[model samples]
Target: MNRRMMMLALLAWACTAAPAVSAASPPVDDAATAQALAQAETRGREMFEHDLAAERATDALLKKRMRGDSRVRGWITEPKDNRYEVSMIGEGAVVLYRATTDARGILAGATEALAVPAAPTAYQAGAAAARTLAMQSRIDACAKRYNSVVLPAPGATTDAWTVYLLPATTDPAAVPLGGSYRFDIAEGRITSQRAFTRSCIQLKRAPRNAAMIVTHMLDPTPTEVHVFWSLWARSPLYVTTGEDVIWKIEDGRIHRVQD
Candidate 1:
């Protein structure tokens, strides 16, 4: 065919192809999406709680070890039955201390062990990898000044990570406002990121332990960082998103409630 004729033929094909391509993609179901988000937030909270319990149970011990033991790099947590196991990971993939702790911070009979099993489990490996990447990220700079959390991604059995960086504050007169970030990572690469605020905002805390409301415009839905913040504060955060969706993050979980 001539060049002009070929161009017209290709144009005709393109006109016909558009509808089929559109038809191939299924429309998003909002209900399902909301449910999925709830599930993800729940899983994220679960993982965070596991690490938190371990930290509470072993922080003093870990503090001494971290200060003196050069081999201690970081820690990993795994769910074991009704309890959670904490392992102080060391150089060359060894465990300096391993023990299980319950929700109340009661540790197992084995308070300390070189947790060298036959091999590292996939769950522990995922937690470890997330911790490693988090330690290596640019976020590391802010960690010493903020409350940073690294958790395994929900629905990912392996090789996925979720990170939360929150501004830490001790001033009783000021409430550290949103200057948080949540990152979704896969196989050592960040796939997506959401920042809670362009920069940190600190509001005066007149009445302490009072309920706080946050205008979250960075995303359509509130993220796990919201949950972590609420958990850290031991207070509920009423997060209003751009879509007019109000999510309540309380007691380490997020739920949508009527505003």
Candidate 2:
């Protein structure tokens, strides 16, 4: 109630409050925080490139074949330096392939090389089934390939993950197949995968040509990539040579390929 008592009470409050306020205050080194962010970005880019190189090597090795009927082609695009496009050609024709990469380049995934069927022999019906099975096998192979690349990375950040998803082939004769993949970074592993089929059909009228296209779009932080495919055309009256393939990519390695 006295003046001295009031001053003492106020002093006690100020001392207690000061420590609490200081403890609650955030750090004030703006420059240091900015430097840390820059370092993370730089490190992310370097890791992305390293991963990309390894992916390219894996693709090149897989492209080599025993019968010489299959071929693989690929290229990388700019800015982030982690995006890529890849394709597989079979029997001088485009079969099936995928294109993908990430900001950190630690994850690169691709589809399996779809095999082109040899001309139907005297056993036409049986040969057609065999060829269809072969194409399906290739799709399965691609799924496995993607799985192998992505499953190795774990704790991968958004910038560290890469994905490649192949929609079911619209061509019934090609065995109607589709699948998808996702990769991790921290552990350098694959996070998930999926595959499916719709129906079965004959390939008597199926075309013999196949081709793939991959585009890498990287800039302004997040990167983008695109994939396209061309397949032989077939019809009742007359057979067309091939159909144009079109698709798009976003944020590093997200792809939208046509079915």
Candidate 3:
């Protein structure tokens, strides 16, 4: 009774306890997980903002050039060593790549143009893959706070996404302003960001720039394309009044045209 019963009892306990011991998890490193997430968020936001600034700077150059004979047909971007190479194409075989700062530095002087292969597909692929990073807690925090939408940036081929923020208020009399950030998907960092309060205020006050886009614009176009949004604003005198704002894109550069 004693020896056999004891052995049987020990065997039963071992079988039941072995499974539980094997399934037990090691101590969770909450700190490490949190830190990794934070870093990802930081990188995502940083890249997005950086790309936005670079696009703006390029737009300035394009609008100026467009006024002349150098009508840009299309363009793309390539990320070099800590820099961005923007290749603007004119008519046929009229390609020129200019290396510029990574959206952080000032767009002061122009770098000499270099011959580079056109690679829009590569950039787009990178952007598509990196988009999953948007779910990271840190990047999500920024999006929630800014009321932003994340998508591929219009114009250029820098493998980046745009985080566009909506205006605080849509009142015509008060003003309509917003902000946007450009993120480099491959690097998972913000390239640049800019606030457009003044432009919004001006557009809001003006009856001409009344019609605005209620819903944000997602895909502008396949190639160099432009988007429009009907600006809607309210005034004490009138109900809802406004005009439309044209977001023009040429070779990855965005410029606003308002009536």
Please tell me which predicted candidate would have the highest lDDT against the true structure. 1
Tens-place lDDT per residue, model 2, 118-169, is 3322222222222222233334343223312111122433323333333334
List RMSD in Å for every model shown.
15.1, 23.7, 23.4
Off by over 4 Å in 1: 1-29, 60-67, 113-126, 139-143, 146-148, 166-179, 202-209, 243-245, 252-259
Candidate 2 shows a clash count of 21
- Cα deviation at 197, candidate 2, in Å, is 4.1
- For every model in order, what is the number of clashing pairs? 0, 21, 37
Off by over 4 Å in 2: 1-159, 165-175, 178-186, 196-259
Best by TM-score: 1
**Which 10 successive residues of model 2 have the least lDDT summed?**
222-231
**Model 1 worst lDDT run, 10 consecutive residues:** 18-27
Q: How much does candidate 1 score in TM-score?
A: 0.68
lDDT of each: 0.59, 0.30, 0.37
**lDDT for predicted candidate 1 compared with the true structure:** 0.59
| lDDT tens digits, residue span 1-259, model 3 | 5753454344335333432112112123477644433443343344333444345546655665433535454343445566555545454424444435564535535644434534435553344344334423242122123323344564546656754444333343643333332333435665554442222222343233122222123322111111111112221011111123223222222333222
Error of 2 at 78 (Å): 6.2
